[model samples]
Target: MPESNNCCEAQGLDAITAKSHMDESIKPTEPSLIQQVIDNPTGDGITDTNLRVPEGCPRIDPCPAKAAIQTQECETEKGDGDNIALERARNAPPGPLGPVPTGHGENVPLEYWTPLGDLTGTRPAVENFSLSRFSPNEWNEHNKKLSAACHDGIQVATTAGFNALCSISRAYAEADRNQMDNNIRLSTRAGTIHRWTVELERMIADIIEEIDLVQEVRRRTMRVKSVLQVVENIDKDMMRIRCFRMDNDLVRDQVSEEVTKELSLCEEIRDVYIRLLDQIKMQIEELITAKRRVEFDWSEKKEAYEIETESRGLGSQSDTILWKAGSTRIPPDQSSPSGYEYSTKQVLAEGYTAKQRSSTLRVNVDAMIEKAVKDLRDQADRVDLTLTQQIQLQEQALRRLEAELYKDLQQLSDTETLIDEMHDASKKLDGAMKCAQTRLDKRLLRHGVENCRDVPQFGLIEEVKSLSESVSATLGQLKRAENSTSSLIQSRRDIEKEMVVKRPVILTVPYYVCDRRSYKSNAQLEIQSP
Candidate 1:
């Protein structure tokens, strides 16, 4: 505990807090006229060469800009610092926690520990202890109090102390486990730093509170209500645990540095995340647009196809019966020609007969419409399949992102695993289609319709082109993310290796004061005699 306390004090996290505050208070220096014009153009044909500039040089028309060399501009959208953040985030970790808030410089507030209440025993004062302070009667009284309190009042403290230790230990362990477990999560939208902050802070706060509680018992001022008061003071307690105490400061800083490295990686991954997310969204929209085009256009195609089917007298040829209205003819049920069932020779012969005909027969509208419908349906199916596949991929990427690439970004095996998981979303889409078909089939029967197959009208040439373009864009975005993620993962590994410090385990607190005292009754007396 003392060692931990000493490290915290020496590390001076308060100094970090003070320095950040000072940095925030300073104003940005305005760029010169030449520099402003040079930095103003984003190469999008947009330029701002205004010579008259105000202090800090507010963004001018057709140009979005921040001061080029400001330390505070590290996270600016187009700043070199942000460009460098992709690589240099871990080089200079932020103080307290989180990214620097825009126009604000508040560090993470420290959290406190609360002790359990109604402790009904006294702790023998150990301050300035000497032989004179422990005469025979006083020593006996203290011995009894230590023994009685050890069993009685100290049970709560012991349990509380160990509980805090176990809690913080598990909290730390969980953080490590999560880093591994979250590898899959990093690939998807569900990935976040919020979980890291929440768990890390709780563990650190509990450790600080445990330390404070130990200090209290050692000083012989342990009281349930006082402990509650300390814990209840949110701001003060938070400061005590998070920012002020030396022990608290060191552990927080050490853990914060490691976690900060992780956060930096997450930010880099987020760069690819934004691009990938945007690309995926565009792809999904294109697919959805293609699907809707099919839904509306199919009805018209179906009508034309059925008309042509009837014109060719295919009613008698189909598996299901389809009769035209006002035709009083009751067509006789025709069986297959004798001995031709299950015989491929007969079918081949029929095709040869048609081919061998001397006359050049005209191509029928029936065949033409059928071919068009078939092609349309094929394109629709392709759109649906590709759309589903892209969505699954996006979700998987977010999953891996949330899990963190550090855990799951292995060379080839992980890629295969992701590809293997690709068929699930399509299956779900198929089940939905089946349900729709069931309902549609009933509606058709009620309306006196029969043997009409679903088809698409116009071939979705424009939509297909659009969809293809979106898929290509999405692929490019994903490739970039994957490539960047690979490098970021390696960087994270390096940071952890450099900054990680193994935390010591905290066991239950010592109970009886005499358990730590000398057993010889005359030892104190003899020392005093000297």
Candidate 2:
């Protein structure tokens, strides 16, 4: 009972000490280094002096350590108490000199008296007797208990220490791993930002170069238009000169024809130039639009570079790092990586295509203007030369027509003969068809099963179909032949009328010559008089 009471008293003292420790630990004081680290994990404002533990501060170890220490101290106190008790028993006086009386009738001093036996015949049961007094001293038993408790406490302390160590080590390892991953993420992001910045720079330069080239093309296009305008003015002057002649002299002559042709050529060339200008203008506008997009993207790239660079600068020791709300989440309208790259490529491609087209147009502009001028100056001579050639060809064609007329007349007679032949063949085919049909009709006269299609019946049916088709084809050929005969006769009549109309008269050419000479003289007189 005393041992149990001592154990309970020790536990009560331990609890009181623990409660007092808790209160002491919770007492407000100057901010500790750990609290500082939590508030500013980067340790930006911390110093080596702050790392030293303060005097009188409670130990920073976990709860189990303190509990184990308290248990060991309690066991030591218990052992000390047992030792004191043994010393007291060793120094005490001896027991009584002789055996005391059993009080069943034995003589004994009253000071060592015994109680009377039960008068109702109630005696102690023999089975209830115990030899615990003769077994071992209470002190020895208590010592054994204290020794076992000390051993158990040692095992518990060792296990708790192992668990605490493992937990702390794992925590430190995880923290380091997280830091490494963060560094890698930031580094990779920075590289991406730098690469995009370089690409944007290149795109911007390309767009600017393209813009310059397109402007040059525009200048060339304007110059070509100006040259075309000058050519138009020259054509106008020519037309004006032709108009100055009197109305009678202004008759449609070679000079007037040549001037009109040149004016028309000049107008056509001007129209081409005007359309080219419009195309160049449109190309320039397209290039400008592409340039704007590139510039905008370039600016965005610069901003992204700045942001990434700033992010890379942030370190564990950086004071500026703070929790930014929604920073980890993707924002609305943000483009994906592929979308960004595609848009950039589209912008560059548009610029390149526009610049290439502009260059091609600029190159062709000179060639087109040169060809137009050459055609304009030589067009009238070529026309007069072609007119002469056309007259010769017409004469040749007239002669060839006379020859064709003779051939056509012969062909018409042949066609009439063919038509008669076709009619005769058609009649022959009709007779053949009737003969085959008569055979088929005779075969049908067989009764019942004998009327079935035999070899001869099939042969007769085929013959009848062949003959019918032949007759149909012959009739169609005869009709076409008659049509050809009619067309040939009409062609002959037309040829005869054309030959008569084309027949030259001796006075007609001479009169035409006389009229041309008179007309020329009149025009010359009017010009000379003016």
Over 219-256, each residue of candidate 2 has an lDDT whose tens digit, in order, gives 65566556545545544554554454342333455544
TM-score result, candidate 1: 0.15
Stretches of candidate 2 above 4 Å error? 1-185, 246-251, 353-530
In order, the Cα lDDT scores of the candidates are: 0.36, 0.58
Clashes of each: 25, 0
Clashes counted in candidate 2 amount to 0
Q: Which pairs clash inside model 2?
A: none
User: What lDDT tens digits, residue by residue, belong to model 1 across residues 1-530?
Assistant: 33322322333444345445433532344233334333333323433443443344233343221232233345444653333432333233432222211210111011100000001011111122210112343467557768988888779898999999999999988876775455344422122223322333343343334334333322221122132222223213222333422332134433334323433433443343344335334433443343343333334334544554444443234675665696875557633434323232343333233322211111222232234334323432343344345335435544554455345345334544443443343344455545555555554565435435444211233344444555565555556555655666675564343322211111100111111111221232122221
**CA shift of 297, model 1, Å:** 4.5
Best by TM-score: 2
Per-model TM-score, in order, reads 0.15, 0.39
In model 1, the Cα lDDT at residue 139 comes to: 61
